[model samples]
Target: MKLLTCLKQIPDRDTRYEINAAGTGIKTSDLTFEISECDEYSLEESLKLREEHGGEVAILTLGPQRAEKSIRKGLAMGADRAILVRDDEGKVTTPHAVAKVLAEVLKEEEYDLILTGTQSDDWSYAQTGVLLAELLGLPHATIVMEIRADPAQKKVKALREMESGWFQWVELPMPAVLTIQAGISQIRYASLKGIMQAKKKEIRNVELSDLNVDLSSIPEIEVLKVYFPVVEKKAEILQGSTAEVVEQLVEKLKKEAKVL
Candidate 1:
């Protein structure tokens, strides 16, 4: 049971962010980075699987060289190895482009399962995992909360959550990707010894230029601008008795916002 988990590094969610003067992106100097929360859940799930089934867990991340910090954290948590697709200057790469790069690397590996977070924290697009599966021509399921593997039968059983308050049972073949849901399991802390050992573990850094992939030829989606969201605060104070306050609130919802 070999597993490939996609990890991403994003700004620390707790930090307040500001857009740059050009409004094309956030101010890099003020940004503090960390492993995305959902991706960490994916890594934890993969580590738990490997710990149970006695196989390898690999971290696949595409970002600048700094992204290795997140991968090393994964290694310390129990991943066997890490692969870095370094993009200097932290340039944006389209989901399709990422799928292409992953396809290039994954074509040579024989893995029983692949996993990814439900979505990236910063982008929250939630398209990469399913898109990669589509590009690789493998069947995949999103919002997976549980998985049961049967190596003897060479099949996997998964429970998927639907938005309509329903669950779906799916049986998928080996080498399928799954976008994992949060709250499925708890993430374990890496022991100090594991952290020390992770420093010695091999992390192969692969460049897009070296992969026979032509960026010039790959037509990626263009982002004209990225900006911080403007936030505004408003308060509606109902000054009256209890029932009158409730009535005012209802009127505000029906008339002012029209979203009851």
Candidate 2:
């Protein structure tokens, strides 16, 4: 089985984000990028499948040239190879445009299964993988928590995560898409030897313009603007007994904020 895992490089989860001078997006110069935390689950699961079932795992990502670092991390973790789709000059890449190029790449490689993260840390759009599934005309399910493969039947049984601790078992054929959820399982780390081996693996580069993508079809579905959350804090010391302070607090809530 050939498993294709889609990964993304996003700003570190704990990185401080400051709006750009244009107020359109966050400042990028001081940011350190890494693989989206949720995406790690997809990569780890794919690697495990390869180790257990004996197949290949490929990591595919689209971002600026620096994103190659994120791809190399996946390679060290156990992916057979990587694909890098790059755009420089700090221009934001759209998901639909990425799916277009991915469709072209998929045409040449026959994959048994495709896995992706449930959502990205940066955009949280949760649309790209599903969009890719649509473009490929393949059955897909998002928020998958567990995966079980049956090689003989060429089928996959996955446990999907939903609201309120709910889970549903789903069956998918060989060629299908799965967007994996965070906390599906623990992620493995890259060792020193694997890190050295990653340098020797192949990483193919591709351009958006070379994919026969029609510019007219791509349009902005949403606009992004970064803003700081409004925050205010006030503290008052209680000067009376516990019951008296509780009474005073209720009065303050009713009269000041009217939220009681």
Candidate 3:
């Protein structure tokens, strides 16, 4: 009944971002980070499963040193411990590289289930979980909304959501991966007791080289540029009496905005 969850640290949603001078990435110096919102849902689901099945939940995260904050937050949310796959250089890698690293690390770990967010807010690639599953030769389901586990039987029923509110229920064998959707359950705040207990939780750091992964290796895809989206401006002011203003507005819409 042991469960593992993958957490990713992303920029805060409310943070005002600015494109870097090279147009290759955001100016991260002033940015605050938090666990991806969807990852929080996956963590909550993992905690809930552990609560019901009476086992441990361990978190796995890959990022720069600052990502330890997000890992600590997961521990405060009741994950028994955590493993941090560190990238000291803070070089942005592809989802494939990340999946490879996770697969390698997970090979030595013992777990009956693995969960990850449907997608990361920063990249929205939504490729890591399934890729990791493929690399590990494990079956997986994405957009998972619910799970019912039977540790004794070594099987779990997963409810997956499709387009237009449709859902598919699947029973997968033990050691399956699932990409969880957000809002599956309410995220709980860290209790004072849980916070204090988390201070003593183990956070084991594993460097990329220790996993036999090198940052200089080439990836399949290269990001040519990363810049802010172009901002379009549209505004109109109507003058004169109410009726005249209305007429002018309608005329302007028909002639200029083209939404008569």
Model 2: per-residue lDDT, tens digit, 117-214?
A: 98899878888889899999999888999999886798999898878978999998878999999998999999999999999999999775566667
lDDT of 3 at 47: 96
* Stronger candidate by TM-score (1 vs 2): 2
Per-candidate TM equals 0.86, 0.87, 0.88
Per-residue lDDT over 1-260 for candidate 3, one digit per residue giving the tens place of the 0 to 100 score: 89999999999888878888887778888889999988999999999999999999999999999999999999999999999999878654789888988888998899999999999988789999999999899999999999999999999999999999899999999889999999899999999898999999999999887776554663667778997668674655677999999999888889988997
Top-TM-score candidate index: 3
Full candidate order by TM-score, most accurate first: 3, 2, 1
- How does candidate 2 score on lDDT? 0.85
Global lDDT of model 1: 0.84
* TM-score, cand. 3 vs. native: 0.88
Off by over 4 Å in 1: 216-219, 228-234, 237-260
Can you list the residue pairs that collide in candidate 2? Answer: none
lDDT of 1 by residue, 128-160 (tens): 899889878999989888888776687888889
Model 2 residue 227 lDDT? 89
